[model samples]
Target: MELSSFLLAVIEDLGADLDPPTRYTRYVNALVAALPGNACALLKMEGKALKPLAVHGLTPDSLGRRFELSEHPRLNAIVTYRGVTHFPNKSTLPDPYDGLLEGVHAGDLNVHDCMGCALHVNGKLWGAITLDSLRAGVFDARVERAMAMFARLGEAVVNVAGLSESAAAWRPDTLNVKDLGMLEAVQLARHDMIGDSDAMHTLKREIQTVSRSQLAVLVHGETGVGKELVAQALHAMSDRANLPLVVINCAALPDQLIESELFGHVKGAFSGADNNRQGKFEMANGGTLFLDEVGELSASAQAKLLRVLQSGQVQRVGSDREHQVDVRIVAASNRDLAAEVKAGRFRADLYHRLCVYPLHIPPLRERGDDVVLLAGYFLEQNRSRLGLRNLRLGRGCEAALKHYSWPGNVRELEHTLGRAALKARRDGLGAMVTVELEHLDLLSELPTQACAVINSVNNAARMSMPMGEVSYREAIDGFSKNLIQRVLVETQGNRAAAARQLGLDSGNFHRMLKRLELL
Candidate 1:
């Protein structure tokens, strides 16, 4: 394909209505066809990282990975350079996608030729279009010039695709950057909705719609499904975004202290009170107050909470004066509050108040290949933390991850990768670590028929147990040893993480490991 024809095609497609991913992908595909490269990617700059928006000739998991400039020298150079930058065949800088090229084996992971040009949309640095070739000297001077022209078309693609609206929305003066810069703030807001699943798309749209109002929002999701993150997203996109978003876990406090925490108490009102403290409501005045585990509130606590919601006023503990507060409420729960209300455990009125606008987060098992994308995100994070040159999933690992029913959801996926990375490193794989299926340690959740088959086998094995031969103490000791050993392996030999999972004290766990001679 000639560069002129490719540019003309992109210009012609400018008026077509297409999704951002589809549009970005068209640009990447066209660029790869026109240029001399084995792999090409269209990345978007977000905060300090570069996220691949579209890819051709790269692994699917590559879409999930975020390349932080500080960690990826090649990407940093590409984005920092004024125009098209080409790396020599033997450049010392590491390739960010060393082993990510599609159809490439592990033995031939090195990218010999590379060139990229940073993209600018409306005079601001948007991202870059990177191309990599396996054969050396493929990206010569002429190819570099073509890349520069393609970058111009890439910028136009972003503009015509209507993504420039959101990209331009985050003005420096409007955002309150306490510790984050303009780029970081915009990036954080944009990347908050990470997945491309239909359920996730619906949830994102609901969040955007509900954020404009002051109605209380109830976030519903299973444990480890990131209900708190949903609350954060709601507050971040709300009208009161600039104001504080104070969070309080209702289940973390005792029944007696719930009121004191929700409504401020005067000094000496409580036994442990050393000074007059403003409660969560007062602290979040004109902002948002996120109540986590809201269904755990006691009956009396529920009444007090209902009163505040009804009156838009709070009376502190041991005080007669009532103070008015302009605060938006966002509550989250793992349990079904409506079920609790039906059972006469939760107040129906309080439930109604909080459920004015409800948002349900889809579980990991239902989000399809989003599991792999999320894994990619975690892999990059682990790579930086573990000080590795590169970290990626091994062959067939993506399929295994997608098929496993993640009962513990996103948190479990994160810990699983963290442990896998540790295991791969401990095995002396060095800087370039690959997490294989075995490293995942996923026990498939069996179907009913499969369980029946296992049950028959278990019965046969039990018949041969010789139950009286082993003493009760011996049986218990064996069980304990097996459990500890399994946990150690699952945690990748991290004794601290293992102890936490088992709900044991660190000191006690260490002593037990010593007693079992497994340390």
Candidate 2:
């Protein structure tokens, strides 16, 4: 086939409606067939590293390895040089895929002539397409010209894919928003919760039951478990949904400012008070006031809050006048307020007032398969943000996500997926990008206990187990406690370090330690 016809055919295949992995496979297969080489691979540039996107002649493990540009001068030369970089068969620099080629023995390091052309999109260096040949001087002037044309065609295909993805992402049917009644709003709010686990269903039922009442609610959960989302859902379903939902982070304000923040301060109340200011309670009159991290409130502020909850009245700072405010309270805390009350750190009256209708959100680990569902949701959000046609989780990625414990919960999952998608895009996997196991970068985030548990499960599956057994729940609890103990020992009594090593937030880690009697 003519060079132009071959290039056209490659572009057509790239534009075909296929998933990311398949599309990438086809692109590399076509490149090797059209170029004067026995093997070819497409690599995306991520920061200073070159990550393999698709390969025709390399082992699958190559996709898991990231080749740093600074560490590999040969690969660096390919991206740095404008035209094709032809490496001699006897080049001193080691090949990134020296032992990674198909049929290559473990100890054998075969040296092959190689040529690479950097693929650029919108005048920016996006990635590279490289070819390897056993025959010396296979890439002559004609081959170089053909390779350059192919790179240009590849860029055009990527641009088109990006445009197509952007168009599909904002399709009218996907984003159609209409006027919603109170009933419709409640239904929509439930859908926004984003999980199908029994825990989620129970929480939804509780929200529904409480939304119709006037009782104060205390949302209890680990940090990043979407406490604020629960508050929003409660407000959305309540009769006060039309009124403003005032939010305040008790932990974010200083002890001295807590009272002033919750109650209006007179003009001469304190140093910074230049004018009379309405507090959250006043702002949320006849509405809902969401007090996040309410356990962080000081003793004085707790007393004032308890009084207001009981009497529906707020007394402004430095003023004799008392204000009547009918505000529904929705408080959240990662800390156990009941324990805090017993420990004399929190006021008992305040704790009792807030715990009137306590609702506990389940941690991410307890919600099986929900992790994958949430991952898919976050991936689509990212794909839309990055103007990519499709973002898919690779098979191994799905398994890893399901197996790993999410210490940071939904918030962490969202951030992790967003970062992974950006990294994938940076690597030049435009349009349809598949989030592979390597893309997740979850090693640092996996808790020590969780990692051990995952590894142990894998190992145990490979070997025969003892006949003696306990219930699955009991066995899991025992395994978890043991893992925690091991991690605590490794950290040498440093709870914070142990928490990080286990990929858990400090608060959750401390709770786990206490629960396991390791504290």
Candidate 3:
């Protein structure tokens, strides 16, 4: 096809109401068809690297890799010149696609010729498009000019798609609640953070604002509220999006290894340390390091961490040499770090450093109708995972979900929906599976006599009627334990089901079991 015809086709595709991925895929495919090359790829400039948006004649794994401008000289040259860049067959610069092409040997680097042009939109360098060949001199002056023209058209299509996505993300203030819900559903699917509530909007705005800076970010939230997702969104929206996002769970690491994990260790630093190794900080150089459950770090570890944050230098265990690292820190904690600092458990200096920009994620119970929106998102995921033709919520299920106090937050809701979907499928509710209230087993969660019993106990100092010499408080405790045990037996040891049956949130149910010495 002619370059003009292909460009027109891409423009038409962009004009449609397609998703971002689909629009990018169609545009790249058209570019490959018009260009003279064995392989072509479209990469978007993100932070200090170029991220692959779409590709032709390359391995799928290439999509997962980012080409940092500092690491690829030829690609950097292309972006800098903002024009056609042609590399001769004998060019010494390394090819980013050295072994990525299909049918190429895993260790071979035989790409003979390559050319690329920087993609600019509205006077800013947005990305680049490249063409590669196995034969030399394929990208002559005429071919270079033709590719440049296509790159201009490609940039226009990309800009339009971006605008469309942004427009779909938010509806006008005039939109009704139902219309807003529909718009939010589309936006939620495309984004990692899922909600349209005011609290969610405020959190998203904070993420966008903080992402533009280099300061440390502290994400505070309750357990299971998706602190990691917040960290991910922060990194993805930041200028360092294309760089590594190294994550370390402080709560999961052993005290003895925390230092080594964060600051590396030289060979023989300790038993079993056979070779020198880089730690999370070095690995995340020029990127982001997400420290999850930061409140769990030991006092000594916190001291070392504070030093790194202050100096931007990490010293290996048992080594005197310090390596400079350029890493952004994003820490998350369920605990109140301020309280920990006041209690002398956490270092005050470290707490202040991480809290330079704090973001709090709202609990699921407070998000109102966002529960229904999230349910739809998880339902669709379950449908695709289970290979079911359709999966949806039945009557009253949405109300039940929103009404229940989700003490376990977003994580709990996701698991509940997943388990319910599986149960529905197993119960012979084939292709068209609608998750009924019964499927959720939440009828037992209706307000029961337990509340009334507690109220009566609170009102009276002592019950006139005592059971077998036990005090009123003891009697009530025994009765609650027996009721929970019976429910557990009925549910065959499914604590979540038993909790729902006993009119309790799963977190509260667990706490009750712990108090009764039954957990």
RMSD of each: 14.8, 15.8, 21.4
Off by over 4 Å in 3: 1-192, 446-519
Write one digit per residue (lDDT tens) for candidate 1, span 418-440.
Answer: 99988877764544677865687
| Candidate 2 structure quality by residue, lDDT tens digits, 1-519 | 766677777777765776454666777777788877756888877666676768876644455345668766788999998888888888877666554454332233455788888888888998898888766777788888888887777777666555554564455322111211232344333323555455665677677678768999999999889888888878877789899999999989887787788998999988989999999999999999999999998888788788888888888899999999988899999999999989999998888888999999988876655675577556645765786644555434544675577778888878888888887777643234666556888756665644556665434422322332432223434666887787778989788787666655455566557757876
Q: Candidate 3 lDDT, tens digit per residue, 86-120?
A: 99888988677654564443223454798898988
lDDT of each candidate versus the true structure: 0.78, 0.72, 0.75
| Candidate 2 ranges beyond 4 A from true positions | 1-192, 443-519
Using lDDT as the measure, which candidate wins?
Answer: 1
lDDT for 31 in candidate 2 is: 79
Report clash pairs, candidate 1.
none
Q: Candidates 1 and 2: which is better by TM-score?
A: 1
Error of 2 at 251 (Å): 0.4
TM-score leader: 1
The local lDDT score (0 to 100) that residue 146 gets in candidate 2 is 81
Error of 1 at 443 (Å): 5.0
TM-score of each: 0.81, 0.52, 0.53
Candidate 1 ranges beyond 4 A from true positions: 1-3, 163-192, 428-430, 443-519
